[model samples]
Target: MMVRLGSSASRYVIATMAALALAACGGGGSSTPTPTPTPTPTPTSSTPVFTSPTTWSVDSGSSGVFYIATATGPAGKTLSFTITGGDDQSFFTVTSSGGLSFKSPPDFGNPQDANKDNVYVVQLTVTDGTTPVNQTVYVTVIKPDADVRVRRVGTGFNQPVYVYPVTDGSGRVYVVERTGRIKILDPKASNPAATTTLLDVSAEISTDGERGLLGFTLSPNFATDRTFYVFLTNASGAIEIRKYKTLASNNDQADTSTADVIMQIPHPRNAHYGGWIGFGADNYLYITTGDGGSPSDSDGNAQNKSSLLGKVLRIDPATDSFPNDANKDYAIPTGNPYATSGGAPEVIAYGFRNPKRASFEFATGLLIGDQGENSWEEADLLLPSDYGTAGTAPNFGWPILEGTHSFVGGDTTGLIPPILEYAHGTGGQQGSAIIGGYVYRGAVTSLQLNYYFGDAATGNVWSVPTQSIARGSTIKAENFRLRNGGFTPDVGTINNVVSFGQDNAANLYIVDADGDIFIVEKKPTA
Candidate 1:
């Protein structure tokens, strides 16, 4: 190869040639700009990359697993995940693979330091080999007792059939036993320490099938008048509606001598002694009785106008105007459905085979649970003539049209169809017999304002939108399936739910024939 040399001078040219020849062989010049160096692209690690964090909550004593997105890259780089900034670090943890989970369940019942409810917060950091993205997460710890339970408020009640909490500021829940004794329960006590017999007519009433002291209620003027009412059957199977005065000295005791016999009607035969009574929103006394003590009503008592047997009788016990009042103790309200010529002035609605229970909501006339003979158990909604009036009308179709269909070959000419009816069966059966329940104006948010009634035989409780009925909507009372409002497991077992009653606070209580009282509260899981 020919050498090209740069000469400092002609004499130095020769030496330069030799140096240039050496440089060509791999020696470099100290001042020459060897072909401007090509610029390499930045390594791609400087840009920030990662997804935003999200928030979450979980019940205390429960495990929770959360997810995160796969991180982006800083060129050929992989991402790393981490967690930071959390209190009570023992309760939660995060894995390097972006999984957030509870290390241990948080106990809201026994909070670590504060009596107040707790919320756990933690930050998740996701890095893409270059920059990190931080997100905030919140986990809530819920109370252990927050989930409503069929809390036994009173136990060993000896056939507690009814629970009536008087609005007298006493916080006493009166439990009526089938053997005819009214027991008292303290609001502050769970199992009754000892049943204080508020009233003992145990020796007076018949406790045969569906007989005995069935149900009772406190007078609207109970606080001042100290009066309460009870429905019972005498030894002769005669239904008696009576009022007794509470002892001034003790809220749990009543004056036996103060018994004011409101009505005493002979219940013939002895099977369906329609045994339930309560004051309506109108403050008027409404009584429900069977079409006599027979199952078939072959005696035609349910359709007879003169008979109070199969009728819903409305009377103002204060006015004492009942046409058949033995003591002139109760006055008939101005507008009785059959006050003119149907059968009796005391008959508000006609044709009930064996109405186990009936209740009146000021907004929606009346809901009568008519126990069917064979096929249909009905919940009849009687609408008032003057939709203007609160609870007014409806002629229930008794033996003739048992639940929208013919039972004893009776015509439906004037029979009001049942708003709801369910056939008899065990699984989802409305139950063999229908026991009327109250419209829930209870404290449970999920079950609030819904009408809850159960079967005396099946313990199956069902609800219908009372508001829907109030609007007079076409929502017929067909046996609607039981709904726990998305709350878990069936409402425990009511064990022959004899009745449903509410405390002064509108907290609903279940009266089980098994001698226990259950209060329904808000379910935490809801």
Candidate 2:
């Protein structure tokens, strides 16, 4: 601009000067504009996260070693779990690897507490690196669908074997101890404590195996007359069914003067007395008899229709005399199976090995349970319509057929089969014996309804949904068979699962051989 030269020449001179100035200022910094500062990006963190499920389900009659699946965090994470709250926490157990198991099945150890619902809350916590997470799972326990609750109500007796409960409309329960003593418990009372010595027949009753006061029942009109009956094996080894009148209302003992012999079945052997008595829906008393003790019906009395041994006898106690006066100690009902078959009039149903217990379902009038013998313990469901009817004979093949299978050197044809049959051994593991139970029909709960019956040897209470038990049906039995339905500690170990009886209100009562009585009621846990 100072030189004022021609346009092109002056422009060239100015450009040269500018280039020189940029080179002096570190390759065009001051003259071309200052360079902007470069910025650095910040890094993000790398931590893992975790989550877990919130609920689970336990099958009915499931116990011990409850395993659960969990959601874990990234590769190297750890988990810790605990049962935060529940009723019967002591009844459960947990493992380090997130496994939850019961010490015993819920209803096995202790009777479900009616006052509280059964519930369990399990909490699980997981950690990944420094990140932590937690989850809570809820578990609910329930009773088996069957209404019967077998429990050990009394203890401290020498070799206590059988227990029978006679209940009043009120919540009073009278239990018969095999030692020939009656114990009473007032369930309605504050403490529901047990009282002793209501009646003691230890002197007259035999305390040997399968003997003593094995059966007891209240008169159909027990409320008004306070009359009751007991079937006992005497010390002299005779089975007697005696009638008694209760002095104290709802008391279990006979008013000394009221000891009248209703009937007696001559028991030749110490074993196989077959002493169980109950009033049928027809109001006739039904008595069960054994095979006259020994194996293979050696006494010949079991197959003899004229004799009561190994037979179901129906009789009227209203007008019965002692000995055989054509019709004294007991009168045969016209509806007896052999009344017109040219056999003994008192024979209701024949071909039983040793019928230990018989119960009448209140709703459907069915006589069921307990056929004892060499290889099989059976449960039979007898229909009222099938009573004394031709073409309806129940064979219960004893010496001939052990269970459903025919054995060598025994009759195989024309034998009635059992509704439910099981082999017996120690605590019912191998082949031992069968203990029968009642058909539950109560108002308290609706878990196990319409099942045919319950078994004692296996400690497995089961049922068939059908109203009447048919031949060769898939009967469902329940127990804690952990691995492939094989052996387990819970097998055949149901304590106090002795006899099944009912009260005035039709509530089922379970008595233990330990002499304890437990009234079955619905105990729901959420």
Candidate 3:
């Protein structure tokens, strides 16, 4: 070290001498080393990821492979994908081609369909062989408690039990009151309301429990023929299907004077008046009749091929010939099973408890909701294989067999078992009556052409695979919640699901005994 000099010239001389001394000693003294630079990492996508639906409708069978997701990794780079989450990640996978597929089909049942287990909360990690990019996403599965809902649309009617739509290209819907009045509704109106009375038969009909104008259907040629039919319990308690034509001046108003008693069946008992009429694609009138009313079916009406009481009858009331039959009101179709069997020519199929509701599936033939006696309620899937081919339409086991279970001395031999059945008082609700509905051949994509039906007492709705019905597969149904508020109603509080109806657009509606109606709708977000 050099000491400070007193003068500037002396300080300059000392500094130059010190620098020369330090430079000569540098090779011998300790020296500091510089650090190696850290090269900046090659830039890549901030978050390279894939996309999938928020939810997916589980398929009916194991064979259907639905695309669930797709991805595109970093450009000009190879991608290696792996997903990790859920009980088994094998159910969902990401392919090297960036396509996602369902490896395992989901069954809408317990454990496999539980809320927690039904979701795949996967961490998608994609690698370009050097660095990995990660993303998290959720894909929900449809189980018994599906993501769909039933929303209330109309309320405050006089004990409305059924609502129907006329596919007559008029965009008009009719509401039938248990009080014996029919009202017209413009369904497409922003706030659809029924204000006009189309027909009133309160003076001629008796309105009571399990009785009244139970069935109504438009004639196939209603757009031109202007004819329709109403099945009702007249003041004398006789079940009648009477024909009426719309007034020429007003399509909404019918000519009461032109009411012709088409066909009337005597079901004097107060219970089990099967009152559901639907025109098949063949244009023949098909009607469902309950086993002559009583607790255990004291009279074997359903088993008897001689009576029209507990049977599905196919007749052509449009002709009004009545040439050979005893009642001579309507002509039996030549295609009926009993037409040549020396049996009641009106009987198309027999053995029903209370075939409460029936409707065609458009492409497939028929589906019937049969009310149970004590334990089970069933939805019957009828096809040409079931009816048009053989001995007769399938004989649904009623008193003979409640569901697939044997009952008190009930006949199980040669009986067609229900495709699906649940215990009545299960899941904190009771299934008192089953209201059969249409297969959802509607605009809702998630519904997947499913058959929608529900229990009247529980207000719990369910959807079965319509395709499974065609393939004769026994896939169970997924349940839909029908609540009071937008999504929540008091448990077991649907009043009474009296009947289900569908419109020309294939949209479905529910009628209740509490004088209200609800429309089944899909979730846009879900």
Candidate 4:
């Protein structure tokens, strides 16, 4: 359609024509041109993730490849792995190939983790060119299923009470029989059944109840002196300590004419004869005695500093202190607790109740198995400072306190409690009699430096960390059979374990009341 222009339209057309004429002729004012803008590149998205599990189980005492880190990242993007944080990160070391391992082998018994638990935690980081990922890893250290078993070394004795290895470089062991016979047998022989009688005093000693040829030990100078000692009950029912000499011509026979009574204590009752004798590293004779054999120690023998019936008596058997008394031959050690004044000159420490078994641990300290009356059985430890003039002799709570529990009526003041104790019953934590064992310094790595003890009534063996005990930690005993259940097929339950013995190499043996001896061994892993 055609339209007519108004007056304002006519003016706009004239101005547009005049501006076009000036630009064509290059007659406009100074002008500026607009610059072009830079374009933004497209961003590439990346997601880094760990394909491995966050939880892992690492075998104790194993060193390599506990975990292998597997991860995924964006295609053609470089990926890296690193350990970033956590309490146990110092224990772990990672490889560029994603293999993770411990800096050293982890021990289950004494964990090196920050929390002292077997569980270890660590933070892991994986990074790509575009994205970074972090993961918290939890590694649980598991104990090795060690295979431990006992191999029978000998049998056919009359209630063998102890097996003492001969220190004369003979490789023979002296087996003590409760029927008043001490037999020498070669455990490594092709026929271990052949035993030679070293001493037989069945006619001179009484063997009625808890009495017999109970304890024996070779002198530390036996190789040169050819001397040994024995503990037994005399015809009058008193505990007798005697000394004898071996024949110069025969190592297996004791010279009957050389037998002499060293000392005798009046033990009227028919039970609780302590009778455990051994030579300490100081070469002094150490003898253990019971509290004169009455329930709850009614005679008050253990607490009486003047009485020798319930004390650990240390003496120098080479010299005589009681020269006037023919029976009292031994001289008290110089550093004995009572050697100067308060109690019997031979008494080193007091307060013991039926410490039937005792041993020195790796030439360091004394370990005693004190049988409780009604409720508990305990293991007592005497450190280096607790004996021999250190003036720290601990009064092991006997009548006053039985295994950390206060008994009927006695002063509990200044009493040193037992380091380990168990209740009375047939369960895991209970046993009638506690047979204390030696601190294992043997070839078995799993049982290294552990104090092995057991119950005589149940024949269940247990162990505690000796290092922890030395550090003054009262730790719970671990059941040996339950903890190392991977025993060999031929191994079975040990019945009536009366005592434990050790050879010169520190190899441990279990002595059965039914006349069997077993050597504890650990089968090698394949």
- In lDDT terms, which candidate is top? 4
lDDT against true structure, model 2: 0.55
Global Cα RMSD, each model: 29.9, 30.5, 29.1, 30.1
Error of 3 at 397 (Å): 1.6
TM-score of each: 0.66, 0.64, 0.68, 0.70
lDDT of 2 by residue, 133-239 (tens): 55555555544444333333334444333444445455565666677876665544544344655667788887676788777777887777777777888777788
In candidate 1, clashing pairs total 15
lDDT of 1 by residue, 1-526 (tens): 1111112112111111222333344537667656766999766545445543354433444433423333555666567777766554455576665656666655666666222457666767777655777766665554543445556667787777777775667666778888988887875563454567788999988887778898798888877888888889889888888888988887568999888878788778667877778887678787888887675787888878788898877777766655575644776676775555545666777788777776665433567788888866777765444222323345677888877777777456545666667656553333678877777655565565567777777676667664444221233323243532222223344657777777777677777787767777665463
Clashing pairs in 3: none
Tens digits of per-residue lDDT for model 4, 328-407? 99888778777777777777778888888899864556788888899888877765455556344558878888887888
Candidate 2 at 212: error in angstroms? 0.7
Q: How much is the lDDT of residue 490 in candidate 3?
A: 18
Best by TM-score: 4
What's the CA error at residue 57 for candidate 2, in Å? 14
lDDT of each: 0.66, 0.55, 0.65, 0.75
Show model 2 residue runs off by greater than 4 Å: 1-167, 188-193, 248-253, 321-327, 362-365, 389-393, 408-411, 425-431, 444-446, 450-458, 466-468, 471-493, 524-526
